[model samples]
Each structure stands twice: as C-alpha cells, then as structure tokens.
Target: MSNESGHTEKLGIDDCTVPETSVSVYEALYRRRMAWDFRNQPVPRDALDRMLATAVWAPNHRLTEPWRFFIIEKGSAASEKVAGLAYDFALQRSGGEQRAAATRDSLLKTPVLIYAYSTPGRDEEGTKENYASVCCAAHNMALAGVAEGLAVTWETGGPTRHPDLAEALGAEADWTLTTMLSVGYPAENPRSERTPVANFVRWLD
Candidate 1:
C-alpha cells in the first residue's frame, strides 16, 4: 500500500507519465508548473541524466545551444566542501543569519544543482533574447523533470549572481547564471490554481 502523506513512491519509473502523442501544445502549455518542497529522498542520477538530455532539445535562434548545465547529486556531492565554505564566507560578508545559511546549504547540496549560463550578446537582439533563450531551456528542463516524476524548484539567489562564485565554477566571464535548478522528489503534492489563459491571450489583426 502507498503512503497517504502525498510523498510516497520513488522518482524513477515509479513516477507518472502522459502520452507524448496524446498531448497537444496548448495542453502542454497548461500543464507546466514550478514544483517545490522536494523530498529528502534523492532522485536517481540515471533518470536525471535522461531528463537533462531531453531539456536541450528546445529551439534556439543560432542553434548555438549556449546553455551549460551543472548538476550535483545529493548524498554524493562533488563540491560540498567548497560550497559550504562559500556559504560561510557569504554569510560573514552579508551579515545574514543562520537561517539564510541553512537555506544556502540545502539548495547548494540538493539532489541536483543546475546552473544554466549563457554568453552575453550571443542571441543577436540583446541580452533579453539571450536570457529568453536560456529561460526557454530552463522551462524545458523543468517540464522534463516533471515528466520524470521529479519535484524541481528554480531559484535565483545572490550566490548565483556573485562574480566570485561564478569564477569558482569556472563559468565564462560573459555567461550569466540566470537560474539554479533543484531537482528531487516532491516532499508533498499540493494542487495548483492558475489564472485562466483567456485573461492573457488576444486575437488581434
């Protein structure tokens, strides 16, 4: 029997799925949401790899595929020591309390810590276009995570924008860390309510 706490089941095949052929574009647009409150249980690496692989398939203006993804596995981190030390340094400089430090540790050491960066001015129109492209990539990644049964949260925080942190990761000088993607199983499932699309769309000639 499954647990009744809205947090049972693993995030691999134990998750749910929708038919690729059955869903329409509008339906997909309506389906996406930002999932937070991830479970303590880690998402499997193989599943994450598959979802990220699918995320890069979004359309790009130059076919540049300008985005770069950084993933850190929970309970098996590659940069935990560095990230922890960085958190301490940041707290000292910003005069932030322990709660902020705790949040930083949780985010930086989550099951998947994805940094999506893109070179500035690569998209021609302006920084906005470059950012838009990266945003599209992020949305693709989030949707793919959802399809894989992972709960994800996209966080834009001070660390993501820090020049020193970017340098430590060896991110390119022109690359902006637009957002950090966290992936894991849902800690709790809460139904979402959204404004009707009719409020936003228009058919003008």
Candidate 2:
C-alpha cells in the first residue's frame, strides 16, 4: 500500500524479489512535493548522478543542451561561502543582523543546494527555447529526486536571483538563473493537493 507521500511501502526479499517497476513512474509523479523542511544528511553521489542524467534527457529544440547544474554539499567550504553570500544579501535588505544570521543558518542546515541556469542562446527564439528546455530539465531532476526518496523544493525568488548569488555561482552576466533546488531527506512529511484534471483541462473534438 502507498502512504501519504505516494511511496510504496518497502517489502522484504520474500515479499518481492525484484524492484517494483509497474507503478514506479506514476508513484514518483504523485509523490513529488515542494519540500521546505529537510534533514541535514547529504544525498549520495550515485543518487545525484541519476538525477542529473535524467535532466539531460529532457528534449531541447536544436539540442542546445543549455542546462547547467552546480551542486553544493553540506558542511563543505563552498557551502559556507554560499551561506555567507546569503547572509550578506539579507543584511543589505531591510532586515538587520538577526535576520541575516537566520538566513545564513538556514542555508547552512540544508544538505544540498543545486543551482540551475541556462546559457544565453544566439537569438531571441533560441533564448526562449533554451529557457523552456531548462525548465523541463529542472522538473526532470525533481522527479528523479522523488524516485531517490529525497525531499526537493524548487525556489525562484529575490534570493535566488540575487546578483551576489550569480557571482558566487560564476554565472555569466547574460546567463539566466532558472531555479534552485534544495534537496535532502524529509524532516517532515508535507502533503499537497492539486486541482482536479477536469478543472484545468479542456477537450475539443
């Protein structure tokens, strides 16, 4: 049976000798959520690799393959540097030292932060295609994370688009910051409801 998160309950070897392939894809799709709270445990390299691999498979017109991913693991020097950037960015805003410190601490506690960007295309149409392709790639990665039993959130806000963050990521001035994914084990199970298919879909024959 499935749980609230739509994940199948684990089975012993006697219960199932092989991986459950029949419903895995749909299960991942249903299980995916925008996770805000997360454990500080680092995601395994193999799992991360699988997520990226799926991302590359997303269709791109002209096969520009403009997506770029930058992974920052917890407790690493790079993580600290990024956290510092968050702190500085927050401090420069209306919030003072306290809020800045909290922002820094929150980022420090995240297990992994993956920043996604799209390289500038040659023309306006190409740029639009690249943007759409990168968005698809990010969604692909998010679904893969669900399959890995990891919590993931895609965020795009002032903090994500901050010039300081762009500089920290070594992003080119023209490159577009797509979104940032915060990934880790779930500290809490969060449930979300979606609009019924009938509510959003229209059929014409």
Candidate 3:
C-alpha cells in the first residue's frame, strides 16, 4: 500500500498495523519508565525488531532520518568487548573495584544494549535537529518496549562518550552518541511520581 506521497506502506505488528485493542497508547506512555533492575532473560529478536521498526517512524525535520542503532545482543563477542569497556569506564568513574565489578556484571547480564546515535549534519543547526530526531526515535523505542512487555532504561553516561568505546564500536568521528538503552524483562516494579501538568504547562492564549 502506498500513501499519497507515494511511499509504500510497510506492515508489521506495530501500532499502526495491529488491530485496536483495549490498551490505550496513553497507558503505554505512562507505563514506560527507567528500569534499573532487569531479569536475565533475553528479549525476543522479533520484539526488538518491532520496537526498532516503530522507532524509525518517529517524526524528523525534513525527513532526514538521522538515527542509527547499534545493538549488542547477549552472548555475542561484541557484547563481551563492550561489557569490558563499560567495566573499565565504570571503574574510572567510580574509582571503586567492587562498584566497577557490579557495573560490569550488570552490563554483561543485560539481554540487549542499544547504542543510539545521530550522524552530524551540514551545520550546527542541522546537527542539533539530528540529535532531536534521534532522541524522539529513542523515546519511540522506549514506549514500544513497554508495549511489548519489556523494561527499558535509557542511559547516557561516561561510557557512551568514551573515545575508546567509540573506537571499539567503529563509530565515525562525526557521529554523536545520543543515548544507550538497556532492555530486558523487569526484575522489580519501580514506581515513579510526576508533577501535575498544570505545574509546568501554561496557557498561551
């Protein structure tokens, strides 16, 4: 199926293709949270693919589609290397051997580590837009993960900005690391409180 713009529509188990259910989108949005504790079970590949598929559909200025994702699946060689890198980074940041060991264990145990990035654009403004676009994409993935019964934690820390880690990932010098998402089944139910919208929202009119 083609839209008015002549782009062929793709079908999947995402929000658009699936039949409407009793679950509302708002519920998914609210259910999405930063999960710190996760089960050791790996997320299904098809579920991860669906989350990424929904992510790419996020709105971007001029349709630049600047987002890129690097997934480190559990038990892969790359995953081991990245986990070591994460351990070293944590050691540097924490300066504690025990903490670093725990950090490394967590990194190794997580079922999936997704490194989201945005390629630099022509100029500063374009680059900024690219970052914004990828951020939206990450949010889309987070929401989709929640819908798929997965826990997702979006993290941007020293490891994500470490030069050695970037080199290990073979990232280009111009590519900006936006965030890293750790996804798996939740081991603990974390509750969060948010301020009322009226506290932050203002009427323009």
Candidate 4:
C-alpha cells in the first residue's frame, strides 16, 4: 500500500519493539479512561481535530468506511437544545423533576460532545460490520484524546439516542448512532480494574 510519503511499501510482519516516540501506543492504551468529571473548559480545536484524524483509521471489512462524527460545543444553541431534550427524556423515564434537572445539568457541564455513527451497509452482515467499525473509530478518538491530554467518555442511553436529538444533529434516520463522546479537560482522575485475560481466553491446539 502507498504510505503517507507516497511510497509503496509492502505490508509484512516486523520486529516487536515499540516505535520511537514521546508517547508509546501501549502507554496511551493503558492510560485511556472514561472521564466523568471535567474542568468545564473548552478543549483545543487542534486536539479535537487530531482525534478525528485518528478515528478514520479504524479497520473495516471490505473497507466500507462508514463512520461519521458530529461536534457540539458548550453554551451554543445546539448544546442548550440537546440538554433540553435530555431533560425531557429523563423526566419521561424517571418521572422526577429533580432527576431530569440533574440530567440537564450534567449535559450542560460538558465542554464538548462528539457523536459517532455509522452509515448502513448493503445487507445485514455488512451493516453489522460497519457498526463495529464505527465503534472502533470511536475508541480510536478516545485514545487520541488521552494522548493529547484530554478527557473523553463514551455515553449512550435513551436521552442520547433520542430521535429528536439525532435529527437536530443532521444525522440521517437510517444511520446508527453509536455513542457520544464527552470531551474536556480533566477535573478528576478515575481508576478501574479489568479481569485477567487468561480468565476469558481459550487455547486451541
């Protein structure tokens, strides 16, 4: 395949050593976390652009690049409308004014919101693969955020997947809404644990 410099390079197995860089890929993978608390400051546009650039590199079967991204900035009319929709959805689900208010407040606090989605494919299997590719693309953006010293979280629920919000964001009705990324500067550090790989792995001879 042709590389960035317009040189054709054959793809083949190479050494296992990490590439030389200020931040290693493994470090980014390890440091990536779902950030809930944010500093309420706007993230740099360049940082977000970097994240989107990496997102397009996600692998997809048959190379059906189907991922799409939408950004919502804080304090904008769009943001206010989104929060209002979330409030309405929450009120319907919980039937509590306090809970609905809390949901609106939480969304308003977010500095930036990124919605990732996938375009439908030709058939059922193709559509499923496209959805998976979009998911990978979203994770790529999250990892890129970590490397850029930004916080990111993938959020999805009734409020986020609401059709009204999707229409407001100009997403097509037929496309799938994968997840929304809440991006900002970190206000807190959170830690989590994962089950051992051996617990879920199987060896086949």
Q: List the residue pairs that clash in candidate 1.
A: none
Model 3 misplaced regions, further than 4 Å: 1-16, 19-22
Weakest lDDT window of 10 consecutive positions for candidate 2: 14-23
Q: Please provide, for model 3 over 52-129, each residue's C-alpha lDDT reduced to its tens digit, 9 standing for 90 to 100.
A: 987877878887779888999888898888878878887888898888788777777888999998998889999999
**Candidate 3 accuracy as TM-score:** 0.88
Question: RMSD to the native, candidate 4?
Answer: 5.3
Worst 10 residues of 1 by lDDT: 10-19
Expressed as tens digits, the lDDT of each residue in 1-205 for candidate 2 is 7999998665444663333334377888998887777876779987888788778668899888899889999998988988898788888885699988987887788898999999878999999999899999989888888878888888785457457787887888788989888889889999988788998888989
TM-scores vs. true structure, each candidate: 0.74, 0.84, 0.88, 0.88
TM-score of 1: 0.74
After superposition, the stretches of candidate 4 with alpha carbons farther than 4 Å from their true spots are 1-21
Cα lDDT, all candidates:
0.67, 0.82, 0.84, 0.85
The CA root-mean-square deviation of candidate 3, after full C-alpha superposition on the true structure, stands at 4.0
Preferred candidate (lDDT higher): 1 or 4: 4
Clashing pairs in 3: none
- Lowest lDDT 10-residue stretch of candidate 4: 11-20
Clashing pairs in 4: none
Per-residue lDDT tens digits for candidate 1, residues 71-96, read 66665444564366557656767777
Which is superior by TM-score, 1 or 3? 3
The most accurate candidate by lDDT is 4
